[model samples]
Target: MKLFSCPSCDQVVFFENVVCERCNHALGYEPASNAMLALEPTGTAFTSVGRGGDGRQWRYCTNYDHGVCNWVVPGDGAEPFCVACRHNLVVPNLADAANVALWQKMEIAKRRLFYTLLQLNLPLVTRAEDAEGLGFEFLSNDPTSGQHVMTGHDDGLIVIALAEADDAEREKRRTAMGEPYRTLLGHFRHEIGHWYWDRLVRDGGHLDACRAVFGDDTLDYNAALQAHYANGPRPGWQGEYVSTYAGAHPWEDFAETWAHYFHITDTLDTGRAWGFVVNPRVDREDVLTAMINFNVFAPTTTIANISDAWLALAAALNALNRSMGAADPYPFVLSETVLRKLGFIHDLVHGRVN
Candidate 1:
């Protein structure tokens, strides 16, 4: 995250600030430019000092009425909504008091989604009225409605139920899935892998390489998922697949690994910014290798493996958490198999393969 400023006093501010500590100006995120903006209230409408792409004026989406966002849309970018807000298809029933709080938690996680998307330069678009493109729908089965609640992804779209925003409900699902760690942001990252692999890997001449690691994604997803649940994974899945369910199908493997790649990159970038590492370059493989002794990403081009870099950071995170009497920050152990996946991800990210 780049540093933000309080537009009122020109003093430095943080991303999640609702009111500037320096000058007390209200602040909200401008998703189009991924910048935090300072605002002055004028009766019903607020004016912000930021321009969207193409030099358009903007303001917070009216959907804040529904509690799903804290973002502004470009005035002349001329969309009816903000970039993040535009993705909504069926929002939850906010008339219910509990749903309002649920929606706010989802917004916080969704904003983090936008931050990573902006940083990675991913393409984002909303599915317009009965039109085709990337889109989203926040839905559920209220018993009043016949449809079942599902958090699933399909054809460049992802559907998440409002209930998943609840911590207890999500923890229930995570326990059922037999996972070590899970969170709303993890779900967002995993689903996004499905969207991005469609753009980055399929039919982009990366199919063969992806197949070698993730398996052929050509099998029927429904069938694979059924088989996975019915019979479980092959005897020892964690030895090969990063996650147990990832071994169920090629597509699942790819999505899981892609999510892991995002996790590694984001954490490394944060570490870089906080001065955990000496270099500030955006690339992870190079930056991480220098700080840790063992290096492995891009072996043909680089000196060696950077396994030690990750280890060092992992140690620091665990130590910090331990100091606070909290669980270790990273719970999973990285075997050689996982490191190879990380290397493949590093290579793919750096255009070493392409």
Candidate 2:
């Protein structure tokens, strides 16, 4: 979420850049340092050409072969994939060209999700490490069998439907679900929230506090969802939930609120990196005066600071999108209840809470 520069040429490159355009140097993201380093070929491995750890040998994640990833693992490490790619349990069948492209798009979003998680210093254990650790299965619908895959989480495995990669298909589902916004990154954030609920709430012994904020998650999830779909959200649901779907269950409320916290922090981090300042000289409102001068990624950042900056930034962004006749980039409102839930997640991630 921060600006990256090519170590070789000092040219600004993006997080997902595989090659530095200015110097043509190969690039790989180092998760430990949270940097996109320029690489120098050194035998079978590549040496980082960056500060602090220059000359460290590394290898691109195996997913890099499919042109889907640019993350690196230490050359001395036994894993063939980087920290991010290792979570992938099943990638789409690459024999199909369309599937290859879909997987690439999904990886882009997944890596971004990993970036934020890593920044938060959240635990990211693989299924190999823990029997129920976080993992992913990128599956596609089988047209021949008329079977469709749903995007959700079970235990710790997050299933991402490959169909979500297609813009038309995703948009259709978004409309059908009555969602204001939905994307591959959103899916990762939402599904991973379920995994975190298990780890941080159930296993981490924060059930009391979590239930207090998110409502009793013990309520029958399926029945709650069935009732919610049969009878839509309560009037003025925005006052209590971030989205209509969030009103379905206490678990869903937590996941939706958790996802929004990630969205707010990561987007605010990006705003800070870009040197964004929402000072709107004409409107002297105190609420619109965020300067985005602090690091949102820092553990010390408070929920108040994040929400304040995010409200101003989201307003500015929404106006920009409206100016161009586009939908609001961020369409959700953060009510006091939602902010309290977000604060709970913020505390949970920072280890301030169980």
- On a 0 to 100 scale, what is the lDDT of residue 340 in model 2? 91
* Model 1 TM-score, 2 decimals: 0.81
| TM-score for all models, in order of appearance | 0.81, 0.98
Query: Which predicted model would earn the best lDDT?
Result: 2
Question: Tens-digit lDDT track for model 2 on 225-259?
Answer: 99999999968999999999998998899898888
lDDT per residue, candidate 1, 135-239, as tens digits?
A: 767775678767777887887778888778999988898789888777777777788778767766773568888778777789898898998999987788778
Leading candidate by TM-score: 2
User: Model-by-model lDDT, in order?
Assistant: 0.68, 0.91
Tell me the lDDT of model 2 at 344. Answer: 93
The backbone clash count of each candidate, in order, is 7, 0
Our model 1 lands, by Cα RMSD against the true structure, at 5.4
